[model samples]
Target: MREVAFIKQNKEKWLNFEKAIFNQRFKNPDELATLYIHIVNDLSYAQTYYPKSKVIAYLNQLAARAFQKIYKTRRQETNRFLYFFRTEIPMVVYQYRRYFAYAFILFFAFVAIGAVSAAYDDTFVRLILGDHYVNMTLENIENGDPVAVYKSGSNWGSFVGITINNIYVGIRAFVYGIFGGLGTGWILLHNGIMLGAFQYMFQAEGVLWESVRGIWIHGAMEIFAIVVTGAAGLILGAGILFPATYSRSVSFKMAFKDGVKILISTFPFFVCAGFLEGFVTRYSGAMPNSLSVAIILVTLGIITFYYIFYPYIVNKKMTLHTYDSTL
Candidate 1:
């Protein structure tokens, strides 16, 4: 490309970046880092292709300014943790909301498929859930305690074990995205099928409502985190498959970073789910119906509000902030 055309092509973007950096208008450190990476790439291109041109000098100056702004010592924000959850993660979520929607749709479709298959074929549930497990659950139901499986261990021991297991699952879901998302899809499909078959077993035994009341106490957060982790995997796959205007390498880097952020955001919710499972789910049968329902609804509401609605709110605020700065 000619130097003149190159300058003309990127001139507006460079100016906007300059304004963002100088005015401290970035939403978070990740956003700044992303912009800096792009600017550095542009600088490298300019140096190689137009080394003697004034554009190279201009880009060098801009890149230097961005480096200083990003890396130079500055006063630390007092509420860095608060800002990350309140602003950073939500913004990233909003940016890739489509991935979340896709993951949800794919997972639920598998769930429906599982449900339909189990309904038609009596043996399907046993096949998916394993014969031993189905037989054990049948025995538990006969003993008048369908969910007694939850009370098998000490509360604190259960909490620690469940939390570690859930975190490991979340990481696996995210890491498996490197296989171009197919691995992640398989994971979702397997889990969805298990869930559908498991629930159907309870329904077959005429205790569907009882099972729901006990299981959803922790399943709300636990299942939601799994879905979000699936989204992270899809994002990683999309980065490789659809590079858009950026080079494949750059796209993958950005996607990996963004996906990791989304995955990390689910850690707290996983911990919450584990805590509920260990401390609350075991006693779900003893609790009043109203209390169990309340716990399930509250957990679902909090996760829904944070992952779904909160992103829109934060993105709107960011858009308005950017518009005001332009004016």
Candidate 2:
């Protein structure tokens, strides 16, 4: 958007924020923090698009003061770890919600591309998944155990190995964002396409149900965490690409901090998914259909709520709680 039009759009909001800062109208530290968030966003825009405008200086000074007030008036929050997970991450995620949309939309589109390409060409799946893996899976399908590969390794060995691998994948996805988010998109594309082709291969073998019962036992949270990590990478890239009112270095530092926090939040989910994959997925064929389905639903629900819905809930409570203090 053009600088003048952008300023015209956020001008009134900035004025109100200025008034709030000067008059001490914001009742709580959270409110000041919230206002600081707004100022920083505007400051980022002005820096990126209106670097030469006087408004960049104006927004920067206001943002700096608001930021100081947030730290100065803040009560030391008890349960720092709990607060980090319960309050901080959710607020950050809410602030960058649009990136989630981008990651999901792009990943799913890539998945569809893989599925379409595989459907038309028998060799596409073998090319993506490797000939040996495809042949093993096909042999397993014929043997009536299409997911036998997951059953290989001792449970503890599998758990530790898989957890580390999943964490590595998440970190790779986040770290790759340093290259302007294209690297992160590539990560998503690689995985999403593989997933699409993998599933389609099972369906073609007439054993999708058998594969899903085992795969989705862990895939739900595992896949969702990857998507969230991809969003964090995009957030990092945005810092480099946008740089609002800050210098490139400063913007990159701020973005890295926020992106790391987001990436760290998914570590627990990765461990959980790893546990399920190592212990439960291998036994999915033996499990009652309802049990397998329940595990998949519960895992999916937990990650979906935490990363997606929970952010809105936390933001709402913060807004209402702080707004009520003024009365």
Candidate 3:
């Protein structure tokens, strides 16, 4: 592509970014990141084909200016974390909805498969769940404490171990997307099946609802994080498979960066899931059913709102703004 064509193609976006930088109303990290990506894309091409061209000089100047303004504003406040939840994370999630859908579908399908298989085969749970887990669960059931599995770990220890392990698994699923997303999907399928079988184990014993109220108090978020991580992997794979308008290398770089960013941003959610599982889930046996039900519903509601509703809201707001940072 000619330098003129490149500039022409992105003239509007560059102009909007320029305006936002000066105006400051929309010059958040999101916009700055978008501008940085655009500038780098242009700079990379220029350096490759026209290293000595005047266009390269212009791009460098614009990029430097954008960076200076971006770093100049430091709004330190007690409510920084509050604002991040209210704004930042939702934007990132919105930008990657396709991957999220893919992960959700993959997990849902596998969960269904597990549930159906366990329904038909009395020994299916034993096969998938291992002898140790099945025996422990049976003992708990006989002792009138069917969900004691969650209570076995100390709060702090379980929190740390579960958080680290889950985050590790999620990241591994994402990293495995390099093998064309098959690796991530396979892991997701395994998890989904385990979850389905685990649930069916309780249902077979006539404690499905009870189990849900106990397990899903934390599993909702934990499972959601896993799906999002899988989405990240698919995002990476898709970028490699479908470069679209960009060159293959450019597409891969952008996709990898975006996928990693989305995964890293879920750190807080993962920790929260672990905390709930290790601390809150342990107390489910004693907590009021009303309270447990409320927690599960509310947690599911929040998940639905953020991953589903909030993305649409953000996309709508962007359309109204005439320039989405996602572009």
Candidate 4:
């Protein structure tokens, strides 16, 4: 690109940096720091292509000033942990909202395939859910309790074990994204198939409502966290597959960090899911229909709002704060 065109292309960005950085007057220092990174990159570009031009000198000066603000801000930062959960993760989630959409769409598609295949093939459920599980569930059904497996373990024991297992599954789903997202998709595929087949088994047994009321007390958040983790994995995959304007390494680093943030946000949800699974799901079969349904809806609503709706709300608030800060 010509120096004139390059300058024209980035003129607004440079102006915005000046406006954002000059006074060190922003509510979100993290965003300001991100802007500084861009400025430094622009400085590098100018130094390479416009070494003799005033743009290099200008950008260098902006970067130097911004560096001081970022440095001082970091040393003084007190609410970093709270800010991470409150502002950082939500911003990251909003920035990568489409990946969540893509992940969920792919998950639902895989689930449909699982369900349709099970419907058409008698042994498909056994193939996916394993013989031992099918036999155990069948026995539970014969005894008038379809999900009694959850009742076996002691409450605290169940909670600890289930929490650990859920975290493991979530981590596996996220780390697999290092393979460029296919790994994450495979995890989704594996889990989606199991879920579909599991549900179809209940439906075929003529106790669909019985199973739902029994399972969804905890399944709501458990499954939702799995899909959210899948989205985190896709973010990793996107980092590797599409670096966009960044070098591959830089893109991967950014994606990995964002993915980790996303993964971190899910830990509480997993814990909550595990708690319900251990303490509540075992009783779901005997609970009142109204109570079971309310639990299901509430659990689903909490996770749905956090991962689906809350990101937009948080992002808008941050944008407004940024705009107001500029004024």
TM-scores for every candidate against the unseen true structure: 0.79, 0.83, 0.74, 0.80
Name the better of 1 and 3 by lDDT.
1
The residue-by-residue lDDT of candidate 1 on 34-101, one tens digit each, is: 67667767888988998888776566555544544443222223576876688777777876788999
* Window of ten residues with lowest summed lDDT in model 3: 68-77
TM-score of candidate 4 versus the correct structure, residues matched by position: 0.80
Candidate 1 lowest-lDDT run of ten: 68-77
Model 4 lDDT at residue 118: 93
Question: What is the lDDT for 198 in model 3?
Answer: 91
Minimal lDDT window, size 10, model 4: 318-327
Best by TM-score: 2
Off by over 4 Å in 1: 1-77
Indicate which candidate wins on lDDT.
2
lDDT tens digits, residues 1-327, model 2?
A: 887798889988988887787568987787677677677677877788778999976786666445444533653357778877887788778777889999999999999999999999999999999999999999988898999999999999999999999999999999999999999999999999999999999988888888898899999999999999999999899889987645788778878988999999999999999999999999998999999999999999999999889988976776555445533
Model 4 Cα lDDT, one tens digit per residue, 50-146:
8899888677656644654554465433677776666667667776888899989988888888888899999999999889999999999999999
Ranking by lDDT: 2, 4, 1, 3
For candidate 4, list the clashing residue pairs, or say none: none
How high is the CA lDDT of each candidate model? Answer: 0.83, 0.86, 0.78, 0.84
Q: Could you give the C-alpha RMSD of every candidate to the true structure, in order shown?
A: 8.6, 6.0, 9.0, 7.7
Itemize residue pairs with steric clashes in candidate 2.
44-244, 47-244
